[model samples]
Target: MGLYLPDAIRLHARERGTRAALSCADRTLGYAELHSRTNRLARALLTAARPGSRIGFLARTRTEAGEILIAAAKAGLVTVPLNWRLSEAELTALAQDAGLRVLLTEPEFRSAADAVHAALPGLRLVIIDSPAEQQDRQEQPDPPDSPDPSGPAQAADPAVPGYEAWLAAHPDDDPGRGGRADADEVYLQIYTSGTTGVPKGVLLTHTNFHAERAELEESRWQPGSVALNALPLFHIGGLGLLQMALSAGAHSLLLPDFTPEAAARTIEREGVTHTFLVPSVLHLLTELPGIERRDFSRLHLVSYGAAPITPALLRRSLSVLGCRFQGKYGLTEAGGTVTRLAPEDHRPGGPRSHLLGSVGRPRPGVRVVICDPGTGDPVPPGTVGEIRIASAHNTPGYWNRPQETTELYDARGLLCTGDGGYVDEDGYLFLTDRVKDMIVSGGENVYPTEVESALAEHPAVFEVAVVGVPDDLWGEAVTAVVVPRRDLPRPGEQELIDFVRQRIASYKKPRRVHFVGELPRNPAGKVLKRELRARLRQSHQ
Candidate 1:
């Protein structure tokens, strides 16, 4: 009987039925329509799969994607958002691991969906058709404002059900408690992006999501606020942000695909008041041609997370966007965000300028403790250790992986984050490096992030990732892969290495520098250091 995602939307529908609940491109759904549509969609889903079943969604950000998410919650089904950027083999692996029996996909990924279905023939497919197909079905031009409220129109297919027609045929009655939903029910299962290892499903419940309500007040989300989200729905940041906006009865604008030009235009036209973008995207937006001409007056806050932002990129973004900026640090297992670096702490030259590098204090009701890696004991302030979190936002554990789940939590029931960091005397959290990414070069511990931060200050370096490589003298050598700025003259290997030497300890400096056009990254914008380590080691051989 606690506040679940569907329950929150139902309340919004009663209080502000005519207000826009979701938008993408020219399509918008008011709270009333969204409520009714999700109800019907929930019933539709119930007919296809039983309550507590895992439902897979393989597509980008769109209004229909949001519809399915809410509908799944109402129907007491667990929603598993699949990253479309992954390869077919990768998708097949995840589908198999999750044991998906039902999948909702769009025309853009129809072939990929078919491939997965072929692998697991038991999986049923529901396709979100294209506008052209809808136009062909009706033999008339579609209206400007009316762009298929449910989704795109029906495509001619006998094997798979059309999402729009399938949804419309179901009754709009509330599914209610018949689905056996409760606050403790597992509602979402998001897979880790596999930055460090193979992906594992993180199971989150209604209680975990409800904990985010505390953050809405801190974010200053109002009923009239409009948030533009360009991050893929499969990502935790994208889904969590949408939930926070909807929980506050605010409108969420989903950008199906992210292009620098498209996002800029959307913000200007839609008057987006809040948004969340990764550092890489922020860099792209600030570097876009004629970026100064765009109007961002309505933008009140830009919350960035998933990866750390370089000082140069952050400063440029502040000057160009002219809005408050907040930084967050969290993992998928922690249910989204745990800490925030507020706008007041983002100043480049202010008294607290040093705080710009910290991830700020823990959010309300969240406790962060740095623990010794070897002894599992609490570390003193400013001493680097594995980050541990205790909060209602923490997920129960991974799905179907009890062994790993058991290992995830410590004796104190705290989720042990594998990232290496320390809490400063002022309670601000500073990330040094991933525990697995830390290198021991000639008996000295070197954190790659500390080395990378130093190289980022170089004018010639556009982007850089530090990794460890094998050496004869040093058990592991620190190496740097750099993306040089197109406009600036590229520096020599020795010069770049020396540049980092001036900022940090000489031993932490990169022994070798490889200039690349771009560094490999996951969808979440985290550098694939493991991949770099493998490729670099192979080159040395």
Candidate 2:
């Protein structure tokens, strides 16, 4: 097999032409059909635009999404999958910033596509899955001179064309002239919602994917595995798992969207061997009514990340899923994971068990160290400091923010993760809390994660976020926002505070509690601490 992702797909298609390569809701594409369709779409793209051009897809995860991604790879164009949940203004901004030439969208987003087209004059819009006859009718000579009221005549179908029409117009024959792309050539530009500001695009190369696959293959994956795709494809969790599944020549059962019942049904029906998800979704699956009635025997492994998982959730998931539960720690800049808590280490014993709060040890081919936040000097083991990682999987830098890139990626190319954590004597990595999220209370420092973890252990607490709120006496007091478990009695604020206090030090317990229906989170399931902090500040004011 070749190194590039596209080459791998091509090889797989040649070897197993009739084998199913991708599946979505009620749809499956065999290797042959996928390859031929992708090739035709690639030719269409190449004929319409130059190589190395940027193409954006503003659509949900469907069978066509995977095809379009692979097609862009074959066409030598960089594919930018815009998060379908992004607002029109946000989508337009991203399209413009990326300088996308062609935008492929679904019919539901026709208005968004129009907005994008209006904002970006150069973008060509192609509607995927739109009726073929409608495209033809729209293309038919638009009533010779019908531009009396309108300043300029527009295509009846504002979308330039449909994906099928474009593919139909192109020949199936491979365009003999193949383009060369280096390992360092930009492969994907995934934007991360900045905790402090606007989202910034993180540029990842083919080499990054290859490196990640190589590392992952050493431990987690093998050929013929079945991976469940429930995470959003726009985030690292979903895309990273997708790459791993594809690299292994495995079957990926794609979920159009995440729903506990749907995920459990897919796992049972598809014999899903491996899956990645956020802890919130895992919680739902474990606590879903009549969950024991569902068959989880097919699930061999369940990996959760994107947020700190509570020990209760972890233990419950392990027992309920009846599989190995692995935790990975990484960010968008790291291209995904720098460390992973192995399935074996996930057992109940030794430092590994003690370090459940930790994100585990650095993966093979990666080096991690805790350094002084102010000086950037390496700190002694067991000391809480900034976590830094060095690996091939680490992104080179943010797309265009040179200053921020330099700040995070040091001269030695080590990425400063901005998270505070320490490595134990046994080499397990434990995260304390975000340096920015740490609370200074009356000359004492308290980590919100520690308190949040304690609160999560309570039976009635479904989800919780802890942030530092202004306090005249303590300077900053810990405040907890809790989403109670379904139909659970609402515990008094003092009772909740006492529960955490009994478990941890009194000072670390939340001084106040606010019951809410849901914890504010981004689309990726990460708690928006900035928003939490803002809400807490407003409460005091």
Candidate 3:
């Protein structure tokens, strides 16, 4: 039999049954306890619905949420984790598209559940949040709350029920009902941000996840490593990290939310060995007051990615954290991370450190190639082109999007990552920018990431985003949106322009600069260039 994620969890439970597996706030769960609870939950789910059903879960970073994910994995159910940040309308639409048989939510999203139920009548809504009084009355006999059984379940007015009471009566034994999951079995239905179009689900398999875990295990991870959990669970970064920690028998310290102060405290108190952050969060941690006073001696690895890191900021982080700072580059469709800069590469004052700006070489089992964007032919090492990846971790295709899947995946099954970049002679990947985000000024290609990286070097600039605005003569003019340092005096737009001009070509410098309090970002902490383009169009009109 092929190895699967659930099988790994079962093995860990047997080997380290009593060892602490997950810690969130003050609550802690051991491996055996987690596995048993997840098994019970899986049995309960099996009793309620058939295997291969799509189930929507709406909750924050709670221990119960983690339990549900593990249970879904064991039960052969496709779990669709909805972002709490999405609107009710978006949630309803996603549920309908996924053909969700069940809508599981906490009390915090009760009203949103009602909205979704109104739109999707066939969905069965189960509220997992039990009232305090209900917990107190667990000893007393209570009738299990069942859904409205009077009428045929329709697609518009869905049935609603409670989860605690249903699971209380079910025995904690394997249901032995789910079909065997093969290498190609769809394990998850994660949705991408609908920036380019309506959000479509991305199907990932057991093989894809296991392949990624194997790659990580072969690299730097070790057993019993304590990793801090701060990234949102809805995204691949957070979910994949959690899976890696579990597979390694590591302890995961979950942060209820992502705040620089909270993260610093957890690192000191829990002795967190590894953590991941984007450029924005790294800046927040380094810039926070009294950061130097914190104890980060226990920190071993700090992996950063999801955006480009400025050389100056990277240098500052190295000095401040005094830890092994690595970089990862990948996308959601590739099951989280495909390339990682090793810990040894982070040594200060070394040649490897000088390549800090690069995204590093591809990891094992991943092959990367650069091809001309227009001609689809291989490009030279130094020439900029579209980056493509062939890996076992890549998704089979976009769910229900055959046309898009065909365009994204070539006939040979290589995934065409919509990123523009080039590989150096030494095989290090240097990202120029996103293909859609590239600015054409006077027929010259100007990558926004290059300009943004240069602007981030300015002492007074706190954050920056580069985009192209419509111009009559140039067709599109380079524009920069900046967030200045809070304590520093606002620098003139011309000063900011001059800052980038000194580092790059004159055409690449921002022709227009706008100071803003913050830049629009998605759930993954990537700046939404589409939003910036929309704002520019509005201003021009």
Candidate 4:
């Protein structure tokens, strides 16, 4: 009777009983089945976990990953989808920090999960989608009457994954009692990539989902269509797509990882209607050999973000897929997207063509303001500053970090997005650079993204990142890290510098260029500026 996520699944169960809700490995699960599975999972979770328990999910994209999110919500638990791509140290640190009651992961990440469990005495490891259960019973010793303080024996047996046991033991029903769901209660905790240091967990309530769902409900996606979720589930963008697909009662293809060939084949074979990918995925798609020979006629929407799409890439994508594209602007703290550039805004020769470089306008019930970083006042249109978001979908706060939360969300309810950007007169949001990436050279502010964008326009520049290095005369001098396109000849460093100088103010040009084989980026596709800075510092002197 409630409107929580599990309630929505149940709604779809009765509304579209036989429709495929999730598809994996030639097996399509109908809504009725999805509803039953989630209900059973929820009941199992409720039995073992206390209210407000933390359940950490560590796996590549899978149907169960999505299931765990809704299942945890139904049990009044917080689902922390851990990044499986992180190093062992990072993963263990995160597991310890979240203090999870249970860790659900895949056999692929078994070692990582084992390492995490070893570090946290109270942590239980549950490996899904493998022969883990059969071997689990054999490998784990019989439980001793005495509790082990340094092991999962304190709670559940930590040796083996109980994924199958949870399913077989529990009945497929809501338990006919109240669960942990309430309007303002936090439902999910997604950790921010600790690019700066230790990643902070962002706490999002059901209220945020309600707001996000309201906007998702406005999508042009048709009922009973198929969607592709190639982005990692640990990322907000991936989880957002899953939420949208489930709420719409649409069939979704959950991928463990994204490869251009697999994505192309999946789209054609599955008749995918919609998908959201980072620009890197799009780049991979275009670079694929014989891609044009393949079928993509079923594609309806191709939404790309996390980084800006170059004009060259955009044109190639338009010619390749011929589907509507959308660009969105958001961080994990904002719950995926508060502003989106719609398909209409991406049309060539359209009135908004000049603004095509911009990420797009604010989405429904969202307001974007360019605030001066120094004074916390709104900057005039076309003036660069910190981009702030006022939206119903913003996270309540970062978990366990009040000072960081206070800085993130100002007194006026605006979430100060660490991204630096400016709004045009037409209300489009153009990304400049991360506020942390801004360089001060002899009293002038130089944004790296502006210089990088100008460099991206060059034919030979496959990728470029600009960082500042210590300069006695200028305080800090702009430095360009270039990755030349494999198909083209490499350009000289000064030639690249001159290209930027001509495109923007000469002072903003990268004074020195360093050519590299590739630019370092996290899975989300954001350049590792801090790494670049460190490398420069080590090399200098």
RMSD, every candidate, angstroms:
4.7, 3.0, 3.7, 3.7
- Candidates in order, TM-scores: namely 0.94, 0.93, 0.92, 0.91
| Stretch of 10 with least lDDT, candidate 4 | 150-159
- Candidate 4: segments with Cα more than 4 A from true spot: 1-4, 130-161, 175-181, 210-214, 349-351
**lDDT string, candidate 1, 400-435, tens digits:** 999999999999998999989999999999998889
How many backbone clashes does every candidate have?
0, 0, 5, 0
Clashing pairs in 3: 121-154, 121-155, 121-156, 121-157, 122-155
Off by over 4 Å in 1: 1-3, 130-133, 138-155, 177-181
Tell me the TM-score of model 2. Answer: 0.93
Pairs of residues at least 3 apart in sequence or in different chains that clash in candidate 2: none
What TM-score would candidate 4 get against the native? 0.91
In order, candidate lDDTs are 0.87, 0.79, 0.80, 0.80
**Candidate 3 per-residue lDDT over residues 291-316, each given as its tens digit:** 98889998988889987788778888
* Residue 20 local lDDT, model 1: 98
Local distance difference test, candidate 1: 0.87
lDDT of 4 by residue, 1-541 (tens): 1245666677888989898888765657788887788778778777657778888999888878887887788777889999988998999988888888888887677778878888876775665753344456667776666655554322235456367665767888764322323767787899987667779999987767642444555566545678999888888888888877887778899877678889999999989989998877787888798988888888888888887677667877888888888888788888778678887777766776766788988887789989998888998999999999987678999888899888888777899888899998888888888898889988899988778778988999877788999999999999999888888889998888888889899899998899898877887787788999999978886
Off by over 4 Å in 2: 130-159, 173-181, 211-223, 349-352
Tens-digit lDDT track of model 2 for 361-387 = 887778998888888888888888989
